[model samples]
Target: MSVTNSFDQLATLRAVLLATPLFAVGLTLAAYLLGICVFQRLGRPTWLPAILVAALMLAAVLSLTGIPYQEYQQGAAWLTVLLGPATVALGMPLYQQLPRIRELWRPLLFSLPLAAGLAVIYALGIAWLLGASPTILASLAAKSVTAPIAIGITQQLGGSVALLMGALLITGVAAIAFVSLLARWMGIRDERIIGFALGLNGHALGTVRAFEIGPTAGAFASLGMSLTGVLTALLLPLAWRLLTLAGMSVGS
Candidate 1:
């Protein structure tokens, strides 16, 4: 009788896990924690960031289980919703870095538009060169912007949100790797410059990395990310429209 009861309890637990969103949430947290453990154990290597590890683990589990991404996203969307509040929280650090920002405002003002413009241009240019369809180019155009803004831009340009999300992940990881290597090679030691570049190029992932470096770096990263998102959202669509009017075909 006791053995039967034990089996029944296990069955009940399995049913609950399958029926509720808790399973997805729990899996995500577990994978992230495991990634953190591995990252620490691996001496915190830059190439093996915790987020990347978590993503790989998640992908493996989904693939092995044959679970559709849409189902998993149903639960994971809760976490995505929190990104806005988390971004707003960065204002505290930005406040702390106000003096530094004021001192460097001139250079930052000049660099922000230039960086934002190049980010869109280069991504579109590369995609066009590869003969990507217009939809693909649109999706790639806002790769450097933050998620919420990127989503809007993608929608405006009639791009695939799914593709944009994938692009954002790839861009973030690549930005972190390249920025680290280039910073070391160029002897750029200022965390401010590094953090700004990371945020401008990588968005949330870069901001996370900047925070890991220090509060000042995190603050600058938040500023860069916010500005880049705003600039890209405001201008990319207009630029794309102008190009289209001029008969600049993006290969479908």
Candidate 2:
């Protein structure tokens, strides 16, 4: 009777795991931890960051298990909610770097808008060249922006939030690899420059990488990410409307 009871309890546990969101959350955390372990074991290669490893692991699990992404996202969405708080927490670093920011205010003011605009333009241009649909082009527009802001932009443009998320991840990894390699090639050792580039090009992931370099680099990365998000949010929509109007005028 005791042996039968043990088997029954195990069956109940398995049923509970399959029925609840905890399984998804647990799986995600486990995958990330394993990714970190693998990343460390592999000597922390820039091309294979922990996040990428985690993502690949998750992808493999889902593929192998035949789990629908929508089902997985049901539980995973809880983690996405934390991005807002995480972003707001950057204010501390921003405050700490105020003096440096003030010292570089002039150049920052001049370069930020130009850099932000270029980021959007390049993404849209590439997607257009590939004959992507308008929805995809819009989704790619905010790939370099952080998640919360990117989601809003994609929704406003009638793009898929799902696609935007994927683009953001790809952009982050690509930006890290690109910046690291180019910085090494050009012998650009300034953390500020590196951080700013990462933030501008990679968004949240870039800021995380910057923090690994040092506080100053991390702070600058936060500044770059915040300013880029603001600029892109405010200007991209307006620019899009104008271009849309002009296109309609031309069509008529």
lDDT of 1 by residue, 1-252 (tens): 999999788778755665678888899999999999999999988767898899899999989866778778776877777777887888899999999989899999999999989988888888899999988998999999989889889999899988998899888888888989999999998989999999999999999999999888889999999999989888889988898777756545
Each candidate structure's count of clashing pairs: 0, 0
lDDT of 2 by residue, 129-182 (tens): 989987898889899999989888888888898899889989998988999999
In candidate 2, which residue pairs clash?
Answer: none
User: Which number leads on TM-score?
Assistant: 2
Which residue pairs does candidate 1 place in steric collision?
none
- What are the C-alpha RMSDs, in order, of all predicted structures? 4.1, 4.0
Q: What is the TM-score of each candidate against the true structure?
A: 0.88, 0.90
Q: Which segments of candidate 1 are over 4 A away from where they belong?
A: 1-19, 248-252
